[model samples]
Target: MRAVVIESPKQLHVTTLPDPTPGPGDVVVRVAGVGLCGTDVHMLAGEFGPTVYPVVPGHEFSGEIVAVGSEVQGYAEGDRVAADPAVYCGSCHFCAIGRGNLCEKWGTIGITMDGACAEYVKVPAANLYRLPQGVDLGHAPLIEPLSTIVHGLDVVAPSVGDHFLIYGAGTMGLLYLQTARRNGAASVSVVDLNADRLAVAEQLGADHVATSADELDRVTTGWEVVVDCTGAVPAIEDAFTRVRRGGTFQQFGCAPDQEQARFSPFRIYNDEIRIVGSMAILHSYGRALDLLAKGWIDSDTMITHRFGLDEYQKALDTFSQGTGRKIQIVPSLAPGA
Candidate 1:
């Protein structure tokens, strides 16, 4: 099988390797589409912690099951599915409390283990969720990230009349806007440095879009929910201060580990502000699938580019340049290519 191999930090190769076989509790999926995000870039740069080099780095993927583990039930060949790449230690204290995302030994498929960047990848059967009959396998990759946002919403716990101010209008931010619109946000405002993304944000239902909060003068009373969807330190700091008194702020972006920002501790105490952090997918995977199946997300707008296995690096370039939205890798190239 030809796969994108991150042999080391700042190094990548598309090489042929032995195709994967299912473990007793796993299934082998013939890869269809895998979405590229900042996490994949960080993994390639060796910046994201727990990224083991010589690994395949695609976590957001959907495909068809070609082989099922002996112990697996209710799944078989020809089943279409999107997988939750998260793999957790079930005995950790966090897992005991239904917080597997916070498990002490938390790991993910593409990050810590081999992943679905190849023609065929093995996945745990427990992680597989069958795609609905009409859902595009190409767009199903969005479900993984959508699930993360769902968990973020769970953390912030938006109310019916809450106004949302989201920083970053990239794929994640626009998805946030759409979800907020559907979930009863009175208004959704977005901030981004990119005009392209901002325009898309408006198309996706962002009531107010700006390059910065200072440009959004009409939001004088502040927002009930302020979310930092951009992992940049400056954006995070600015968004954090925009939360209204008694409102909630969520850190939904994955910032560089060493980056730091200072928040006004006194304001948090005096104004009763709530700060919440969301990591990865939790129990929200199935809900995300439901939302996708229900046609809640505009798949056509979210995905902007597609590439075959040979064009993986080109896809990376397009993603890093911020010239496109979600870029996908279609790995099922001609056999032995």
Candidate 2:
């Protein structure tokens, strides 16, 4: 099997490795598509916390099952599937309470274990969701990220005709904008430092888009719901103050470990504001796939670039440049590549 291994920070190598055999309750998937996420970039830069070295870094992926574990019953060979990368200990307190996303012994694929940047990757059979007949393999990888946004929206519970202010115009922010509109938000505004991303937000149904925080005028203030997708400390801080009194502020981004932000404690109490931190997807994977299958989420327009397994460095460079929306890695190269 050929895999792209991150030997160290800022380094990647495409090397041959032994193919994985499915263990008990596991499935070996022939890698089809892998989406490059900010977490992958952070791992490459040694910014994300406590990642094992020489790991194949990719979790957002979809593929066909080539081998199934002896104990697996619901899945078999030739099943097209998308996987939930978050491996949780079923007996943990969080898992007991149905909050498996916060499982105590959570070990994510591609982060703590071998990921999908290879010819074949092994995953727990329990994590596999069979892709619908018409869903393209290329678009199946988007299920993970889309699920995250769905989970966030579930927590915020934005009402019809509610005003929304979304910070950042990246994939997550743009997806949230569309989801909010679908959920019946009458007016939505997206803010980002990148003009190009803001433009995409506009196309996705954001009523107003701005590049600077200062450009958020009085009319944009007092939004019923404000979402921070930038994961930057400054933006998170701004969100706390910008949301209307008694409104909801959703932090959907992951900031650096050492980053910190301060807010007015008195105002939080006085305004009766609700501050919610939405982490990874919680029971939203199936719903996300359903939406994708129904054409509610458009992966074609969101995915801007694609590269073969051999072009790992090129893919990383293009992603770092932030020239496009989403970059994808095709693990199996085409003929003559």
Candidate 3:
């Protein structure tokens, strides 16, 4: 089987590898589509802490099950599914307390193990969520990322009429916009440096879009819910100031490990503001899949580009350039296939 291997920091290649076979409790998925995001970018550059060299880097994906482990039950070959990439130790303190997202030994599929950026990849059977036969496989990859958005909302626990101001109009931001609308937000405002991304935010039900929060016409107190989806220091700093008194601020993006942002501690105390950080998927994958099946998200508009396994580098380049929404790699095809 052909796979993309990150041999070391600043090095990557699409090369052939032995086909993966399922373990007693795992299943082998014939890769259909895998989405690329900032985490993959960081992993490629050796910036993600959990990632090791000579690994395949792709986690947001979905495909058909070609082989099932001997112990797998209630699933069989030809079943279309998406697997949660999050791997955690069941005995960790966080996991014991139902916070597996912060498990002491937390790891993810692409970041910590060989992932679905190949013709076939192995996944724990318990992590697989079946997709409806009617759904398009190309768009199924969005479910994994969307699940993170779901978890973010769960962390915020915002009121139905709360106004939202989200930083970044990238894929995660756009998903946040759509989900906020569905969650009964009084208004959803999106901010991004990219005008094209703002336009897409508008198309996806954002009540307002702008390059900066200063350009938005909101109350002097600011939005009831503020979210940072850029993982950018500047964006996170700006987003922190947009939360209204007694409102909530969510760090939903994967910021660089070494960066820091400034916030008014006095204001947080006086205004009763709550600041929370949402990690990766946490028991939300199934809910996200159900939402996708219910048409809560516009998957068609969310995905903007496609590449094959052989074009993984090109896909990563486009991602680094910040040129598209959800870019995907279909491991079974060539560049334009």
For candidate 1, the 10 contiguous residues with the lowest summed lDDT are: 328-337
Name the best candidate (by lDDT): 3
Error of 3 at 253 (Å): 1.0
* lDDT, candidates in the order shown: 0.89, 0.86, 0.90
Give the per-residue lDDT of model 1 (tens digit) for 4-43.
9998888998999998988899999999989998888888
Question: What lDDT, from 0 to 1, does candidate 3 have?
Answer: 0.90
State TM-scores per candidate.
0.96, 0.94, 0.97
Off by over 4 Å in 1: 333-337
Residue clash pairs of candidate 2? none
Residue-level lDDT of model 3, residues 1-337, one tens digit each, is 9999999888998899999989999999998999998998887777777786779888999999999999999899999999999989999899999999899998888888899999999999988989987678888899999999999999999898999999999999999999989998999999999999999999999999999899999947699999999999989988988899999999999886767899999999999999999988998999998899899999889988999888888998998888989999988776777
Comparing 2 and 3 on TM-score, the stronger one? 3
